[model samples]
Target: MNKNLIIGQFTDAYLPITDGVVLTVKNYAHWIEKKYGKCIVICPSFPKFIDEDNFDIIRFFSIPMPLRPPYRMGIHYLDLKAIKRVEKIPFHIVHAHSPFSAGLFALETARKRKVPIVATFHTKYYDDFKSATKSDFLARIGVDIIVKFYEKVDQVWTVNSSTAKTLKEYGFKKEIEIIPNGTDIIPPENLEEYKEKINKIYNLSQDDNVFLYVGQLILHKNIKMLIESLYYLKMKGFSFKFLIVGTGKDEKYLKDLVRKLKLDKEVIFVGRIIDRELLKGFYARADLFLFPSLYDASPLVLQEAFALSCPSLLIKGSNASEGIIDGYNGFLSENNAISYANMIEKLIKNKPLLREVGKNAQKTLYRPWEKVIDEVVERYKELIFTYKKNF
Candidate 1:
């Protein structure tokens, strides 16, 4: 059987731009093209390069996003003229990533073309809205907009079970598929070299335990909480180096906090590193991964850490902690400073437990992209078959 596939995605951000959405989309697009020939990625044009043989990227004109909060909601103005360009192509499926302006345009195009529309629930926008706007009223408006936007799609997919539940709560009638993120396992040989490079950059000792934190420095990430916990440990005379990977709007604030708390020597913020292999190496070398995010939905970093057998310290109730079994593969703590500090102290006091948890974490294998793409392909086939039958 011959198949022609065109995927329409609306993301507030894309590559050269860092976030979970960009990572998910890039991974999905790469896997789909490798398996099914070619796929098109639609988003705002950024300076990043999308160099895949079978992938065609379409960037719509957009304004510069605000630097203070760091996202693509307010900055994007849907160029109906640019969107009109997609109408010229014969697309089979329209897949949107966000519920912002670009998503609305995608939905409209799908309806006009009479094609199947599929959307993936990505960001926890409502939670983010509350934090950025500080208005529950506005946050409610955002939730309503998301509900209305998603209601028009044929299929909805989420990265975690918690997000699926959230979709159902929002009055979505369609079945929401739960598909977690996946990563290519890093080889042991490469990890050793990566460790040496990282040690040289940070001046690390072989005896020192390095706790790594990878991802944005956002308020919702609750990185301050992690710094506070480290401060608490220092108060008790515990010594360890924290290697913070990635950068964001919170860099200056976090640096200030670290200095104010006298953790300048213990904490190192090694701003955003682009090399994927280097990131995987850091994951493998770390004694433990610290992610104290108070709000998230299945962050890819957690899965990356798991793939590398890096034990994690995650905050409870966050979507990333869903599949985690506390005390087995990682430790879960509340959002409070004391609770997080206590968990870190426990790990410091019991070194053997860390090794055991890392071993346990290695046992989990997540193949979400494979499974999700298979399901998506099957859905495409069904949609095409039904379209022919109906017409």
Candidate 2:
């Protein structure tokens, strides 16, 4: 709790993207500045997107990433203007959310300042590389670079134990600290009001079963499996409404698949919502959240849904489903469409079970950013103390 501690948060992702890592870094910057000390966010610039946070944001030069739309590749070293601006800030300890250009810049800054640096491993990088490059050899090389980056950092962190294990699998042999992601939302008091509003907007009724998925519409997130499972659910003569609330690289392919499966009427894509309250309304309206992603190490959307008392049905044994218990706080199904469909069919009919599980999810899963950042700043303090003593 050093009020004079000025922290640097470096990342490749930021505003207008709305992914988990961006949200994580944003919350970290927000809460740290509010309660502890000054925090500056350093990330790649998104064209025409003005940052309006209480804390300062320093954006560097960037170019659009072809494979990942809306996310730019930062060329931090080339941005002399940004470099000169950041040079004046007195950063005590720096944190990197990505090992790309922004992270390297953070590493350089930490070295120049003679301060400890922390790097958080947040994603399954191998999957991302293989998806973009379509080569296992290239993917392995990418993971090797990721491991080398973590090895260079003063401290390494992951969102959960499963994520730590993932880093270990990727050949990082160092110790990792677990700092779980937190949601900014809480259970809405007027849940019924939001549910009614969503029902009217989407042409749904009180009795109709509504399921939701609010993330990138990409194959890597196993969105294909979700669409196929819904096709099976329809084939089994069930009536339901599905709302997919995000856009991604595979949006066209996923939409085409839904058309091929004749699920056009049942599935609705509410693309890229920025309003948290509006998103919460969708969560409030959902009977269950369907997220079967094996790609995500730990998804913030899952916790967001749970905060609104909406339970999720995740893939059995998947990393995102690590802390979930089947048929208790949440539901789990086998990785295939048939098994997922079968589980959905059973749950859609039992209203009592759905309500009970949703309540349990709210109790077990919702951890607010305020509580999570208290722990984070304390860790920052410890790292600073130990690092300075040793130095």
- Please tell me which predicted candidate would have the highest TM-score against the true structure: 2
Tens-place lDDT per residue, model 2, 146-220, is 899999999999999998999999998989999999999877899998898898889898988999999988898
Q: List runs of model 2 lying over 4 Å from the truth.
A: none
lDDT winner? 2
Residues 1-391, candidate 1: write the lDDT tens digits.
3344656555667776778888777766776676764567777765445544357777777666675534444223456566667777677777788877667767877788888777889777778778778999998787888888888777778887888877676666677876566664443555678777778778888778789999998877988888998899889888899999988887889999999999989998888878877787788778889998867788878878877778899988887788888989888999888889888888867778987887788676344466656766776667666766775
lDDT of 2: 0.92
Cα shift from native, residue 186, model 2 (Å) = 2.0
* lDDT score for candidate 1 against the true structure: 0.76
The collision pairs in model 1 are: none
CA lDDT, every model vs. true structure: 0.76, 0.92
Residue 275, model 2, lDDT: 81
Q: On a 0 to 1 TM-score scale, where does candidate 1 land against the true structure? A: 0.91
Q: Which residue pairs of candidate 2 clash?
A: none
lDDT of 2 at 73: 99
